[model samples]
Target: MDRNFARALSLVLKSEGGWSDNPADPGGATMKGVTLANFRRYVKADATKAELRRISDDQVAMVYRRFYWDAVAGALLPDGIDYAVFDFAVNSGPGRAAKYLQAVLGVVQDGRIGPATLAAAGAKPAGVVIDALCDARLAFLEKLPTWPSFGRGWSARVASVRRQALLISAAPLTTTVSVPSAPASADAVAPTAPPAGAGPHTGAEAPAAPPESVSPAKAAGILALIALALGALTAWAAHLPCNLLGVFCQ
Candidate 1:
């Protein structure tokens, strides 16, 4: 696992802080963002509310690193992207966070990060995916039923993540992908090259321009000409009966 991820994750854990039990929050009785239910599940020991009040920071960090970070494959992701995804997973869930990254990468949204996801993420620039993911996250948060009560805080958190992620990703080594010295084992399938026209087509020819518009005066003149032709036709039709007969009938 990337050591930098742990350092950055520490910052996120700090921001999340310790112990919140707002009635509006659905998590209910969260300590360091780990709810009472999760803590019980992770610890696997029955503890009273009084004991939960004494939950340590170290315990929280372990739960986050194992359940949240490892689940999302944070160590393999780009620096800024890992933090964004990790924090998002903590806020939302692992499945949603993985699916969100997949959505931005334009890959399968199976809610699990695997070979395909890692390959796509590594191939693309981190900034582009980070921007898109953050935008999508905000748009999603805006539609939630709880937005009226928690929208401001959610928006601020996303913004903070976006800014910090970008900053972390801006580091020289952050975006670099390392290649293995030896070939992969038999089970590993190497990433294939993208198909033709798969990447951005910068040199694509511009579309043909639309036909020019005619001025109002020019349009009126054309209409007048059509009217004159109709008038002449009418006059010819009116004289047809007289011309067909031996004498004038009109």
Candidate 2:
């Protein structure tokens, strides 16, 4: 395994959390985000619930590699993009995650990573590809029936993953051209001293993020509304409080 890929998988595991048996969770009896069914399928072990609970860290890693990382060809992707795609697969599925990457790259979204998708990814800068993928991910998640139930956490995860992917993409191999540092404001000045024990001050922040493309955001909003409309058809589902959904309630 590539060291960068190993590192990426480590971060994904951290984000996926540990065992969960929430009643609302579709993936029943997941340990470290590997569903029980998937665990059995990948490990070829007809392990009982108790045995699954005792699954080793090595087992979990292997399962992730087989089902998610390797399935998405994580080793072939650029640094930040690799982790973003891998994590999306873990949360969503490998097929959907692959489709999201394809959508971002303007490739045929057949939900399979083919030669064309790989070629497009190879040609694009990692930062650009990662940002677009995360945007697409958030859009797709907003369309899920579970969004009202899990949107807040899901949105936060997307945001965090996007930032991390950008950081990783910027780390090595690329020149300053990926993102040029903005010039300091002509009127900018060092801050005055703080209170006695306030400690040292920090420097200028990064330039504001470029304005978002309108189409994805608009499409995502429409899809989220469609999902919300359909959610009303279910007796078990209700409009979650906007705060819980990570939206402005008022």
Candidate 3:
């Protein structure tokens, strides 16, 4: 019901930390969880591993906010569910993440997070959705050929994501419409899924989807630091004081 991009992104970055270029990784090489392709499209066309390794936090945040977070409609989604889906989108491909989320919601398995999906997701409690979505995500990952190498790490990540997502759902979330994975499996031909939050693009999802529209809430909390920079992307009314969930705290 509100925008939680900053908070959500912060949590995700905790998991994405640093750079890695496992040759077994289908996404090739990545920096701060971004694939070489995404870096090329967003920051540099001729971006090299060296440049990717040194990607600034600002750039990393920009890519995740516009691509991964927004693609999963993080701003519109409930707190915990928003994080769960965003992390899922980052770890697996956004298309597959959206479909799994829809599966939990019993909505059509279209790989997009449109109004219908929003409404369905909103109707359910964020905690329940987080649990179901995480379970489903693990189930899918467990069956992958790479599970032997990444399964334990993936399970740990999903557990942590579930735990944190539930915490967000429990707390009143307030960051509202903000920006916006990785993967392979039985659906190898389906969409790309980064090995456990490894990347954020896959499947039929466009490299970038327009950030979902969201209603503005009073900019509460101290983290409105980027309110100005975000501009039209996700501006909170700084004058009014509200909690992270956009509700008056006391």
Best by TM-score: 3
Please provide TM-scores, in order, for all candidate models, with all chains considered together. 0.67, 0.66, 0.67
Q: Model 3, poorest ten-residue lDDT window? A: 214-223
In order, the Cα lDDT scores of the candidates are 0.83, 0.82, 0.84
Off by over 4 Å in 1: 173-250
lDDT of 2 by residue, 1-250 (tens): 2457667767777777877888898888887787889878877568676777778888888998888888888887777888889889999999999988998899999987767988899899988998888988998889999999999999999998998888887777655556788897756774454467764445645444569777988999999999987877662344366546777644
lDDT measured at residue 85 in model 1 versus the true structure, 0 to 100:
90
lDDT of 1: 0.83
Q: What is the lDDT of residue 174 in candidate 2?
A: 57
